[model samples]
Target chain A: MSTRPLALLLLALACTLRPAEDHVRLDERVGRAETPDTLVLEEDGLAAIREATPRGARLWAASPVLHLRLRTAGGPFELVVRNTLRDATLTLDDGTVIEREPGGLPTEARFVLDLPAGVERTARLAPPDADAAGSFHVAVLSDVQDAIGEVQDIYERMRADPSLRFVVSTGDLTDSGTRAQLVRFQEELETLPIPLYSTVGNHEVPGPEAWHDLFGPFNAFFRFRGVAFSLVDSSTATVDPALRRERLRPWLEAHRDAPHLFLTHVPILDASGLRSGAFRSRNEAASLLQELADAEVDALFFGHVHSYYAYSLAGIESYIAGGGGAIEEELDGIGRHYLRVEVDGARGVLGVGLVRVD
Target chain B: MTRRHGRRAQVTAHLLLALVAAGLPAARVAAQAPRTDPSADAPAEPPPPEAEPPRCSRARRRAAPALALTAGLLLHGTGHLLACERRTGRRLLAAEGLGFGALVLGGGGIALTGASRKTVAPFATLAILGVGTFAASWLADLYGTLSGGANAGRPARAAPFELALGYRYVHDPQFAYGHGLHLAAEGWLHRTRLFGGAWLALDDDTQRATAGLSQRLLGARGRGDALDAEAALHGQRFGTDGFRTLGVDVLLRGRLELAHLGPTLAGSFVEAEVGLGLQGFGYDATGRGVREDWNGLLLGRVGWGVFLGPSGELVAYYDHRRDDLAGGLSVDSVASGVLGHFGLAGRGYIRDGRWGLAGELELGSALVVGLSVLHRGAAPREGGAR
Candidate 1:
């Protein structure tokens, strides 16, 4: 009896685990407070996270460089970097080495340089892009949770499309909501030429704190140019009817006139409705579709169905862009791919193009 | 007696409330067809009181029990295990008693006249005794009818086809979303009832399906009176998860009636069932080789059902199974009174995982609602009473 109790205690402790520690983090001191977007890191600079941690992964190097949105026409700007010794030599894209100034703080390498705005560059110290929100070309991706190891091809594909501004994903960035999966996912994401904004999927439901630590929130609203995007939580089917009358209805009503796009991990109804593999309640799904139609939402994108499908329901254009390096479905006849959505400031959505990577 | 009557009243009340809530209103699918001929639809014209048969001679009234036995033995009438009342009892008793008594004499006489002494007397005697027992039971039924009780008549026959739709929430932390839609259909051909269904996640790319058949070898059409043998096949798909399953199941079920006194469980009953099955599946994650395996499992269940009038049933059951069906590849699901005709339903095996709190009403005829929904007894393509 006593032994059984002891075994249960240990089991409980094993399940409620803390985030794993990264063995590859640089121990060198750094200046300024590190965040997620500051330093430019190569593959070597990205620390591989330990597996099975409760909180998943996080990116920090004082601040890893995610994007350089240059707004000035042309001017001198300071670049910050970490994990270095002495005054490091900074190389430009053309292979020109400039001696770093013994600047700001001794813990980091800060370089002040002049560059033209509106131009994108990749270098040893400042792989960069200018702020160009005027052309909103986003790559929609999802369901790459356990397959981050195979995502390098996807990243390369995005880099090839310099016109693609960034990535917007619905969820499933990891397989088991583990720290290692998140870290690996983040590491692979850094390979892309642009940053990624995403809302958590069911796989990210391990705990809200861990998700908040990495991605801002499970549901969010952000706008670019003249179009708006809303990412809502459909992670749990059979949502309370009141949720519609409360949060969702008001939000949709507020943005009724704006060209808007909705993002979720699940669809209101599967195109293969015959299989009944869609929402829990036809009543609820029909209501959601009606609401979207009433709001005249531009498009709704989802990613739980590991396949590429495009269809319209209740007059709303919808697509399931789930081919994100996870297991491929032969029936879908499409290889691993992402949807490239072109948006014009004045005209709203132009078209959705399939970019196959595998 | 009063306790049982009160339960019947309570069950009737709940049944009515459930019926109204189950979408039975002006929006009903169709009006039920009348069962009787045109004249029967109107109130019966009263006959002169002088036409009433003289109350069974007081002496014959006391002999009603014996007469019931004699009539029932011949397979003719009924025996009223009666509770004397101020009125109506004897009227019902007379209908059952005299009717059955006539049949016993008639059917028995035919049996005797159809053969010679050696075969005739034995056959006649056997026929009389058999019919007598039948009549006794019929008379008891007459008593129940006079009581204006539910479950007063034989239960509705299982239609050739059944369709059900509902919602479910799974508690598998390893899986994607937890809630989804459920759709099922079953057909009857003689002794066999064939069924199939699917469960799909509302948000995630998860889906499961199953098909099966159950044959009632003996007993039926009433609560606590049944025996059945069943078999089935199952399949499922979790998109991108690279998981699938195929399986077989077999089982036997039996039940017994303890009392025929009231509607619902106010009438006592008992049931027992046992089953065994085998499941096989293929699973592959990452670049790992396709892994295949077969597993065998055991299951047991016991429950009781209450027949609540023209239609409707309330059942309570406890079930136990040794393993998860199809290694999580196939979802084993059901609608209506969890046991297919009773109350409660739930799926899972986390010690506290399996449970179902359900209620059904035969509204506009039959539609189970609350937590789950099941449209019962409408034959395929043909309109049957709801």
Candidate 2:
């Protein structure tokens, strides 16, 4: 009779002590800005970040900071800044308050907004706007986590292909949702010669709100070659219902006929976008996939179980790109591989291939 | 649940922040030094970075090695139990010798597993492997017992093979002999831990035989026999170290045998053991042996030990046996010992798939030791940590 409580107490103590080794903290610097580099914006410095980008750059609306890889006639320098909704007027040291266009940047022959004198700012070209003429193809990689070497190899090979445009990641970039894991994921992504646009996956969202707050608008969308590339957050688990039928269904339907692909962290069914599984529940996943299928979506890409599975259900080709990440479960006989798509005017044909850097 | 999750999140965030902050000083130090390109070195270079020397106060550095030694010693108390059977002759000693050899070579596996920078993957693997080895050793013991003396030294021939080797020895003026070697292998068959092995022995007297069989049992703890032949009852008392076992071995064994015991002794023994325990000993029909005039032996088993793994535990057990001699002379010797075991094991994907490692230590008057590595399921070519 007395043993029960003692056992409970021991269990409680064990549980508390279990995670100590994992909680090792080596130092104390985070969130605090260091050094006044023209590239590194201190708090909410929109002008500095923009000054770092080209004159007419169309940026992600919710992006908090603009990362600039400064390239001069001499060499290259790197800069970064926190750009919020607030606008800022870029002025040279000689009082040149450059007349900047208000919204929707123009594409060709964009001016290089030189930094204030005495402040050596590195300049990098931002992604060209959708209005730019030529259509390009993005890899749309998803869920590339701990398998750093393999993912890096894939990135390098993709970089070598001139036909390939910038890369788009459909989130779940880490396995344990740890900062180190996220950082390593970012480090691997940084090796790409082209730019990368990413959306959050279920694994990326440590909590419903915390990670979203840290990485804003994790569930959002963008346009490439006038085609709608929606980064919809289909994860109903461990998150708030920012994805409502009234919000997503109509938007998806509106862009259904467009030459577009839906990029998400969950899979959708053919009938409805409602997730349902006894052992593994994707209640919202079912609804999303169903909606895509009903809409005749071209391609659906996602990852979760670290497997490579492709299903052509209801006229939609669904590909699981989880092989780029940790293989927690069996890879379902598909050794780690990546997808390279050729997107012309309309049809997007994906070719799965090996990344030979090992 | 929310609170727990919140706490977990908060703790994770704080810890991450702290790690980044701590790394800052080093980053700053690096910044201060020459900005050497990390990629300048080749990838195949044997360890890109040496383990940082303990850089603390003199007292701290001194304390670090002491702490490490203390931890090693503490873990040592839970070393491998290579011999868990009675010192039937000298088999237990030989098994211990092999176990020691494995320990020296085996510690490298633990070091390599521990040295991995990936946090979750390595420790998770270690914990799993440790737990698994602990379980495997126990299971092997049970399987060996169930299969009887016939299946003693052969390893299971299948995918994900696991192996164990043990030797024991005892020397006394009266007995003057005891030594045996045992080897067993296990593998996955329809998701069940199935195994087989062979055992060999050379005693001081001149009794030698080779036996082997295969068995399948619940993970590491099971009772019963492969085939039931005789039904007899017997009780016995056995003591070793600081323990004693008083129980009856209810056995029914009917088989053939061939032996040449020189001119004085040469014959076969067929018998069955039965009864409630050692206190209650009795005999029944179905009996034959070289010492026809004398009766059999009553036996009990007792052993205890501490395990070194996460589930490290102190286990003790007792058993008794009786054998009827054909001649007037009857010999009954009690055997007992303590065993301590430490282990590390886990399941994960290496080279992008599933793999696992298991290791254990057994120590006592009678000891047995084993180590096994396994990989199963399809592996993703890409590798990672979770």
Candidate 3:
């Protein structure tokens, strides 16, 4: 055989092996975004700076924690952060507290910082109540596809609960992942009392790559009060093989000894195999489950099936809570609901409660 | 272009390239061989000599193809019945019915059990078998309808033993393996057939091997159409990925001669198999030392093919399993979640049946292409009739 065909085949293989752009863009925006001549903002997790200026910055904290380093010429600065729990507080490295002012939106928190000229001062912002090694509650919601209009009521219900720290979603935040729809979803989040972290779902694939641009990273990890949360992108029914090997495996390994909760848009193995609302390959699913089992993950959460299911796989507690008011799966009798998961730093998941909105 | 469109274009281009590559050799063989009745070289036992049967009219023959293309595609065997092959039609229909029954039972079991891993092996096996039988019957119906009726000549039987050596190319985005050396051997002794194969990746440190034995349950092994009960053991080591797997399976496999369905379907055959297996995956690089986990595996295959001369055959098949190298598709549709991989394979002997050439292509989560040279220990035997 001529080497020409072999060379062409190799070229084609190389071209095809290129990773998905969504993951690349996501990796780029995870840690920090910079604005020249202004303060440099750094986040411990998958947060994004929607707007940045010399005096202040608008932040979307995908995770509950943010670390900001100011490079100002000794003056007062204002910082506005969104998607944070109600009890969030800002404190200087010297242990001085910075009181939060009432922002324009209920979910927003504004803090004034006085910085010494030519000296970079670091500030830590986080929910103080969730920082301890005690049990806390978090709300889980997903699949608000066409129900974007009706999600406010769900958030209202969440807001009424004083015990809930924040919300985490498995994805499908809009009917389509269009920029307008994503912005609308974020706008509605202003009604909620706490932050909502999410991974993208299959429904988000159709519209151009606006989900990541608007909502930060599709894959992320964070720790709240000692409990580890890992969110992965299964929007296309399969995680990119590279992502699984390089990102997911490391995330699992890093939190192997902690009380880790894994969340993704699609279930790795659908409890009801008939619907197959899960990974594209059962082998892949099996492999992933084995990895999780080896790591001793506390629980798995997923949303895509439009109904709720609580099942166990590989000895780990798993739940599918897709009841965010999308078209319902009829006759199941459960609709428009979210899960209230309680976790402790010292212990694993305490319990998962189902909260119905309608 | 958009990413989706780009990916589609790439897949289409590769598919076309594979088609052209596969067609060239087959086309060359076709041109070299004489244009004669395909049944003259059928690899099945000949029917006992009998009085001449009335031939169907041209319109009836044409109608069979039409029916097969239309209703027969869904209602398998309708075309065979229309062509007056009552026994074969009824058998095909029975197979279809049994397939559906198995599907229902298996699906219901899976749902009832909540797809629990404990009891999933048997149910999944049934489901895979059901799907394979259903599809194979339909394809068989189409083949029987299109093949022109020819004399049911006995021709020659299959070689008793064969050895093959080959090279395989695999393109999987998940792995770095690109080239593999393949070796295989199979032999028949009395009523049993034993086969073994190995694939060693040349570019990466991955190796896989499979060994199997099948006991003939019905029909003659020499005729190349039989019902077999098989047991197989397979193992693979992904040296670069720090993992390995070992599995064993038992299957009930059958190959039916389409000529038995009708003389018009001479020289063609359909095969179906379903099985269950247990596999253990061992990981070497986890936080905890080496860890091993087990999972249930469902295996199934269905194919349609035609005999090539007296000792060769070409087949197109669907393999409903993901544990192998081809794995499963990673598409953006629900099919990615449910469907398996597709493949095409062919082998033909030359140089007085002492040497042969084989080629294969598989499409799944990966694309695999392989070509091999075969050496036969014995030439096909002649003078046998059913």
Each candidate structure's TM-score, on Cα atoms with residue i matched to residue i, is 0.41, 0.34, 0.69
Rank by lDDT, descending? 3, 1, 2
By DockQ, the best candidate is 3
Clashing pairs in 3: A74-A117, B149-B264
Q: Provide interface RMSD per model, one decimal.
A: 24.4, 30.4, 7.2
Fnat, one value per model: 0.00, 0.00, 0.18
Model 2, A1-358: lDDT tens digits are: 5799999975543322121111111001112222334233322111212233222232222222232332232223222222221232233334444343443222111233544433544332224343344456666566565455457667767768866565666666665456667556555655565555556665654443333323345544544555666665533221122343434466667776566677766443211111110001121222233455556567777654344556553346666665564542331355455566655435444344433222
lDDT of 2 by residue, B1-386 (tens): 53324544554566455445433443343343222233321111111222233442445433433332343232221111111122210121222222332332233232322212223222322233333233322322332222222321211122344455544332211122346454555554442435454333344322222222222321111111111222223211111111111122332221111011001001111111222212211111111211111111222222222222221122232222212100011111000000111212221223422454443332221222334444443332221110
DockQ of each: 0.01, 0.00, 0.18
lDDT by residue (tens digit), candidate 3, A271-344: 65534556655545655776788788999999887778898766678999888977665447787899999999
For each candidate, what is the lDDT?
A: 0.48, 0.34, 0.73
Using TM-score as the measure, the top candidate is 3
Clashes of 3: 2
User: How many steric overlaps are in each model, in order?
Assistant: 37, 107, 2
Judge candidate 2 at residue B29 and give its lDDT: 33
**lDDT (Cα, tens digit) per residue for candidate 1, span B162-205:** 56677755433234456678787877776677889887778788
| Candidate 3 to native Cα RMSD, angstroms | 10.4
Superposed on all Cα atoms, the candidates' RMSDs to the truth, in angstroms, are 24.9, 27.3, 10.4
Worst 10 residues of 3 chain A by lDDT: A13-22
